[model samples]
Target: MHTRRPFRTLALALGTAGLLISGCSSGSSSSGAASPAQAASVSPSPVPAALKSYYAQHLSWRDCGVSGFQCTTMKAPLDYAKPDGGEIKLAVSRKKATGPGKRIGSLLVNPGGPGGSAIGYLQGYAAIGYPAQVRARYDMVAIDPRGVARSEPVECLTGPQMDVYTQVDQTPDDDAEVTKLSGAFKKFATGCEKRSGEVLPHVSTEETARDMDMLRALLGDEHLNYVGASYGTFLGATYAELFPGRTGRLVLDGAMDPSLSSIELNRDQTAGFETAFQSFAQDCVRKSDCPLGTTSADEAATRLKKLFTELDAKPIPTGESRDLGESLATTGVIAAMYDESAWPQLREALTAADAGDGSGLLALADSYYEREPSGEYANLMYANAAVNCLDLPPAFATPQDVTKALPSFEKASPVFGEGFAWAALNCAYWPVPATGTAHRIEAEGAAPIVVVGTTRDPATPYHWAESLADQLSSGTLLTYEGDGHTAYGRGSDCIDTAINTYLLEGTPPPADKKCS
Candidate 1:
């Protein structure tokens, strides 16, 4: 369900909330003071019964665009437990198959980021990027989740407030700075409640997964056929758990393991960034554009760290009042970690930054933040925080927990540990109660499910693929010994062929499929 675009748009440079971390603390739910009676009735159900009727009414589609595409809306109960209560609208789009043969069904595609816009993916990529033959036989579809774009989105800070938030130091120098950083996170959280309170509590991934089933029913598909990338893998796997019997051909790439808590997720992700940095370092040593010293990767890392520190103290002016500083620079580097293809561009940016020109690096940071030249933000970051905060509670409950866990994160990536951990602090003061927990998904009754892993994937670690494969009753592990986030469309002919064969026919690849 995710696409790892090599180059980012201005706003995408900030992050894709595709993974979680562990060891962060927690607090009481933030859903606010419900009466005891109302609270008592609010139990998490295994499956909401109201979803069936909701699905039935939502399947009808109307004209969307070009000849084949259709658009519609699906309604989900604001709270799954109160299914017949207030509802939320989810926007749906589909491109019907141009088939000369029997149609398979709807194949839902998600482009990673628990918050990424499925509608955007459908319009921009899935409409054309999917294999033509597959497009010919099955309807390709997308649905923007509850608090994502097109759906009722969650907005926290305004443009000016966000500019300030983006500039918050990810790595604090001492107790005073840590308090300042925590205050920023609290402000963002409070802003969400103040600006978008109504929809904030309903954006959990579990809720989204249930919404997907409603989409499946409306589409009249007997089973759910899906291809999920990055965080999309998590959503698909969750669906398999809830509706194993209704699970069809499912593919999860850049896999995330449900068994791992937030801390573990963050630590592993930090290590992944390290792996990617090492790969970049190795390649940079052989390239003329390399910015860091060529003595060794260690020297390169040290030099980069020094540069980051220097920028932290005296940020380079990018002509704009909002210029590239150390925190944004660090974020920009981490964004490149998502795809190895961006290495050359990263090298260029680093070289420019080293030469006292911060525009290149600033541009990269702007892309991550999805910031436009005028300083407005795309809905990406807002939706990301909404979905993430709703899906899982805070990774760390308090600043003290972050301080205690710093060493472990530092061990993961000496350069990025502190920043990532601080970023995890955003959910601490979430407006809604966290509805899900870290649990393994067996997806026991499903048909054969293919799990693909890119060995050096910075977003989702390779070990997670192995873990998920081992956990699933009918999971098959497919390995791509390459550098990148996901493997299928990144030029591994073997990988493409294997998945294509599986989707076109009913056969999976060889059990031990490997692509180098």
Candidate 2:
């Protein structure tokens, strides 16, 4: 059926860097006052002297390859438990405010892949696309968390190897195919251990959150002002939980519920994608060019399943040497479901594939894998599995586990069920045992935090935002009654205005505000 993108968000177009710059300034005190009762409820261990030294060190910034963006490297302990043990270099990037008025402090933005490159996101999108008024008031900053791009990345397969990995038939028809898929997963996991064994155990979200605190201190900000999407939302929440007194103006869009086990998360995500596909199918049938017929969503789904079966038997050839197989074709469809703006493109790809041309759909799949025309790939998928595997227990510990859960997963989404069920096995073969566990994050004394949820987000379901908001001690839920992966900066003036007001004025919207 459908394949999932390992990472969360798509890359924004890289734009020309500007020539505006501003200075970093220090400040104290968060927007919301922490109640004494809230403060007393959770007493955290004091920062060790060695760790404090790491946090207090200054960053030496210099002009980067991008015009206005400055880049620097910060050292973080590989293991927080042993501050003096070993260190990892983190890549940091920033674009200072271009202001006509007073500056507000630094504002950090993360485009959530868990593996997504925050530095790339900042220079490519946030620095240029964020609200100008907000940009004028704060230094837009991003850091590539350990084991991600630009920092010391987690390397697994080579481009050609990854190509073969992505093409593996996810819906195995027999024991041999299932064994082959398991082999593929084992090969991938083994590759990560061989290449990145040192960093694999320390790349969990909790460690990344700790790194953010160090970044905040180095940037001289008393509190963190941040925007996180998809997996990044989980990260921002972790920071709030770990550093409640330092929490400030956090916007968590497309949020994830930390309390979910891997099994629940995967099952929920499968259902989410099914919901998104229903929406797409309903809209697709209305168009004359739609290849899946205009009868109904069920009919469209049946037609799609038939197409996938056909591709499984005989893949269609593309302009490039690579052919469009069931796995790639399914991934292409899933990618388009992330943003409705891509629906037209998905339709055209489907029409071409139905007519024997597979280039368009292959291109979409290529983009999802970050596969360059030269057959090169970024480390996104590798890092995605690295962090995801270490953050929580595996969804399936063995093929038997997947077999037992297959029925329930299929019930979640008939079209994507089998594929996702097999895909969840990727983490089961991981070499490193999970270092973290699913738990509630109260961030007891944290300031007002804004959690934005789109009604039908495929990756991070809406109910997750509701759950997270309810879990956090001071979380406020902001609902966008629409479709898409995230809400803010996607053409809703209402959402943009509310978020901008929150970041600039330190006041969030009403606790349960709903925007169209």
Candidate 3:
């Protein structure tokens, strides 16, 4: 039930224009060698004989149901280590560039769900809402990663089962509650193994990055040009590492540091969400209708925590089958922390929750889970756990480990720490062994890669962006001293111009260049 922070906010926040101002700049920062633009050879590494067909396959792009967009499918090895063992089809989509400017190449984008549909992202916003100049010169492309939406999505529990899973108390107050939470995790793991055991081991970020290279070749591009946000940044970074020579114009927004272990990531993210909430608290106290309090940020946070305490005692009715409990209310708050524009909504939701109407908070939690009106949930949470559990070892191996980590997590964020710490236990019961380990991604020979960070980002915190930029040999750091998840296209003309210039001109912004 921990959202490892979906990068979907890139589209969710940017999708609404009137809600953003987009200013990002930071004070002192550090970066690695900022190399000038390195030409991307159309000729990437020679295709291995095993992958020749996958590389040479033609995409039969046709009108997707969505206007101005085309969709196609491409084949990839289900188990990349064992190519030809079997094939899984990946869904791809594109919007061809308009005129008035020469086409640069295909600009691939991922909104980061590990489960977020890149194809959906392209159609929903990237294809049409991106800067016109950039769109004019590039074919906006997206490939739903192997187990994500549009592709053969990894299935787990049914709608009713997921409902039970989401409502399971994350912050266990006693042994019985703890046992219940642990049982839920085991059941989820068993369900996923029963249904998607085959694909679970194959959905690692490393595999998805390889899939991108395949899509790159099929698109007839010499090098890959991409914009990845949140978890997408990790995917892009992995690609750059795996195929440094073929990386071109990569913009890793809201970058993630691959060096952190699962424990480190979860703890840091705990602190990050707290940081974002603090920012929200400060802003909230300035408004007259602030539910927590207008007295002060500290008081507001205290009040919210007190509300969570009350909800733990008795859940509030949402006018639906589901009620607003501590777990869902926490999720609702975390969802709003992704974008500042949602702060007002969070305040209103909290106000309503305080008044015994939990509908608003439930709605927010539903959106976070990608729950449909039909009561079915998107594969988002399922695939999120799939990719995360496979990409790194479980954050905690047992309930005892969670108990040991609670104090440290609480120190990170007193409000969310306990629940977040317990949430990390969700993956401990995974059926598959993790295939990836936490390590630095140097991508030494890649072209100048742009790494963006938001100072108060709730997920994929600013420090992760700084760490990534420092790790990559040719990374250029672009700091956004602002709130929200990803920076580009969110309204910072500075952020947009810098990234667009990099994508269009192959010239990254100067290292440590803060956005304004």
Give the poorly placed runs of model 2, Cα more than 4 Å off: 1-46
Tens digit of per-residue lDDT, candidate 2, span 1-516: 222332344435111111122353332222211212222233444667878889767787777756677877899999999888899999888888889667777889888876778887888788889999999888899998899887899999998999899999998999999999999999999999999999999999999999998888788776788999888899999999888988888999999999999989999999988998999999999988789998899999999999989999999999877899899999888888788888889899999999999898888887777777899877878888999999998998999999999999999999988899989999889999998899998889888899999998888889999999999998999999987788888889999999999888888899899999
For residue 194, give model 2's deviation from the true position in Å.
1.0
Off by over 4 Å in 1: 1-49, 58-60, 65-68
- Regions more than 4 Å wrong, model 3: 10-44
lDDT of 1 at 201: 77
Question: What lDDT, from 0 to 1, does candidate 3 have?
Answer: 0.84
Q: Backbone clashes in each candidate structure, one number apiece?
A: 29, 0, 7
Per-residue alpha-carbon lDDT of model 1 for 132-183, expressed as tens digits? 8888777888898888767887887788888888888888898898889889
Question: Per-residue lDDT of 13-93 in model 3, one digit per residue for the tens?
Answer: 323211111122222211112223356433346888989888877677666656666677789999877897999998877
Instruction: Tell me how far candidate 1 lies from the true structure as C-alpha RMSD in angstroms.
Output: 9.3
- TM-score between model 1 and native: 0.89
Q: What is residue 244's positional error in candidate 3, in angstroms? A: 0.7
TM-score on alpha carbons, each prediction: 0.89, 0.93, 0.94
